[model samples]
Target: MKILVVGGGTAGTIVANNLARRLTAETRSGKVQLTMLSASDRHMYQPGLLYVAFGQMTPDQLYRDQASLLEPTIDFHVDPVKKFMLDKKQVMTEAGKIHNYDILVIATGSRIVPDETPGLTEGAEFFYTEESAVKLYKRLREFQGGRVAVAIGVPHKCPVAPVELMFSLHDYFKARGIRDKVNLKYYYPIGRIHTIEAVAKWAKPEFDSLGIEYETLFNIKEVDAKNKIVKSEEGIDVEYDLLIVVPQHRGMEVIERDNLGEGGWIPTDRHSLAMKGHDNVYVVGDTTNLPVSKTGSAAHFQAEVLAENIASIIKIGAPVRDYDGKIYCFIEAGRDRATYSMFDYETPPDLKPPSKPMHWFKLSYNQMYWTSVRGLL
Candidate 1:
């Protein structure tokens, strides 16, 4: 059995590593072979991007060589995917390499396209990438203080990140002793500040206490970046000294070009994460069109569930496990304190106020993730 996993991101790495453990016997007997295809050699710790912007972490610490994360027995290829020939069960690489697989796992995730919104790419600073976070850090330091508007253009990966960004920004400015000088505000298209009603309810009082104003249903129609103003379709206008935005996120262009997604997102079973009509192909992470937050925790749980299902499928042609849509998010609430939320599809998030103990746990997770998740999980 040939298992080809595209992407070396959080979901891909978890599934690949766990599969290697579960199929050790088959792999040693040459009955199962594992391969991972990555566009870049680096596996970016995306959750650390916020810390980088807040000057809490350095860029170098957030990335690891993808090749080092895998066992030597697994085939690790640093090649960009050109397209997918699903009908032929072939993965076409940019270097003209074609790899055939009996089972393919598509964990390519999603990408943020600044070009999706006019003036957004050029106008506001985002914290999704290393360069963007670094630039935002510099810009945050240089700004004396004024009206700061954080906006969202479209649905993004890590849906909770924008909310967390607002909290961190508040903390950032407060630490500088210029919190009053900065009139911080947040705007998102959703009807509520957060998708989870319980989370929003928990944040409402917190936002009220922090004097942070927020506007919902504010859809961005144009970003007048040069004028430092954001205009929404409803004629709502906001001016800002600094614009922090979470721009549009879509599935990889390759998935779109190959017509494998619905509006650049893969349609998969919410429980199994298997691509519809493609029994042997599976997907997880941001690329899947699930009405859930694209957080690392979601991917972590999905990876475990998918790995088990794959093992069962290869043995008896039926996936026995199901994903519960579980997610855990640790949100920083300024200073060195954080709050946590845990939930699944059937349950609402149980949220609490920020505390120092949770903060320490959040800090510890970074090291734990880099070392080994088996114990932590």
Candidate 2:
């Protein structure tokens, strides 16, 4: 059977590689043909971009050649998927090629939708993309310090990123000896700082101690860049010398145009990572409408389950595995320290509350990063 994976970023690369390794044995030889289609040759470690913005990581460390990372046996197509022809079980690329597959995995991740909000695309500076982050960093270094506002648009990837930016900016200004001259504000439409109640509870005390001003339920209506002001739906105008925006997010357009997403994200079985409507289609990572934070660790966990399920289907023609929705994130709070939380969906009747490890855990994890690369790749 032929399998087509329609992305080459974090989720796509991991799934494809895992399948290649599993199906390489003599017993499964010639039984599967794996192909990965992506729009660009650059594979970015997206999580590292946040550090890049803070001058913590260099640009070279954030990228790798997509072609070099894939297994030699797997076919890699560098092209954008134009549409999905479910009727024919084929995917059509912008280059006019149709790839037929017995099984299709829709791993196309979400994208930032700045244009969804009026004036945001035209006025505010976005830090979601590498190019934007670089530009913003340049502007930030030259900034003399004043009213700096970090606003989060609706439905953002890595929800904690805005808060991280807030903390880092606090540290940035304090180190520059202009903490007194700078006024920092964080605005979110959500009533709480984090979507997870437990995390929000843990973070509230930190915000209070840091003296960072925040406004909740404040939806930005427009950015009057010419006037250096952000107008909210609540009739509040926030003026800023520098505006850092986390733009709105949406599933890949190919998913929406082809009616693949249920609510701005592909609806997949939380346990199986399989698309609800299509038996042969599986989705992993940020594209899914799972009620969890979209992070790389979540993708890695989902990929592990997805690879096993695909192997089971090919080997025994049965979907025997399920995902547990397990995710762990290291939230950096600057000052060479970080906080972390581990969550699992398959807990027993009652489990203990989430635990927050000290900065030492994060420090040790940084060393483990090298080990992870060695083991996974």
Candidate 3:
């Protein structure tokens, strides 16, 4: 059996590593072959980008050589797939090489498209990438007492990030002793402060306490950079001295180009994580159109379940597990305090109060992320 895993991000890496370990015997006997294809040779801890924006972590600390994180039994390649010939059970790479597989795992992650919104790329400061994070950090430092508007775009990676960014911004300005001078206003495309009801309920009071004003149902339409104004689709215009935006996201271009899914999100089974109508083809992470946050935690959980079922099918002639839509995320609530949310399909997350200990745990998890991706946690 040949297992071809694509994308090399958190989801792809974990599933590939887990399969490599679980199928070690079969692989050694040449009965099963595991391979991974990724665009980059380096694997990035994406959650750390938030810290990078806040100056808590540098970009260099967030990466590891992709090969260093993989198990020796698995064959890994940096060539990105350009074509998905699912009917032929093969993929053509950018380098014009063809790879055949009995099973395919598509974990190609999402990307931020600020340019989708008119004038947003030029007018807003977002920290989705390394360079953007550094640039935002510098912008935040040079900022001195003005209207700091934080706007959110839909279908973003982390669902809780808008609230988290608000909390962090409040703390950042407060720490700089300019909290009184900075007018922090938050805008959301939805009807609430956050998409998660529990989080919205919790964060609203917190925002009020911190004097963070908010306006919901403010979908982004365009930015008038010259006038320092942001116009919403609802006919409301907000003038800002500085704008920090959480841009919308879409899946990789390869997925879109192949017409595998709308906006590159593959239609996947909620439980089995397999692409709809294609049992042998699986999807995970941001590539799946799952009703879950596009966080590393979701990818990690999905990978575990998907890997287990695949390994079980290989070993026992039947699959053993189902993904329950389980997702866990740590919410950094600022001021050296943090909390977490854990939920699945059948249940909503119950948020706890932020605490210093929880904050410390989140900090430690930044380093532990590498271990977690290695299938150790």
Best by TM-score: 3
- Weakest ten-residue segment in model 1 by summed lDDT: 368-377
**lDDT by residue (tens digit), candidate 2, 1-377:** 89898988777878888787777762257668888899899887777677777777667877778887777767898997999997799989999999999988878888998877777876787678888888778877888878888888767788768767877888877887888788888888879876666667766777788778888877788998788899888888998888889887888888888887854598889998888988888898899998866777787778777877897788888877778778877777765556666788864222123233554665565445433422263
TM-score for each of the candidates: 0.97, 0.91, 0.99
Q: In angstroms, how far off is 101's CA in candidate 2?
A: 0.6
Provide the global lDDT of candidate 1 against the true structure.
0.86
Question: Which ten contiguous residues of candidate 3 have the minimum total lDDT?
Answer: 154-163
List, residue by residue over 263-345, the lDDT tens digit for candidate 3.
98999999999999998999999999988889999999999999999999999988899899899999999859999999999
Candidate maximizing lDDT: 3
Query: Per-residue lDDT for 174-217 in model 1, tens only?
Result: 88999999999999788998877877888878889999999999
Say which prediction, candidate 2 or candidate 3, comes out ahead on TM-score: 3
Q: In candidate 2, what residue range of length 10 has the lowest lDDT sum?
A: 347-356
Regions of model 1 farther than 4 Å from truth: 372-376
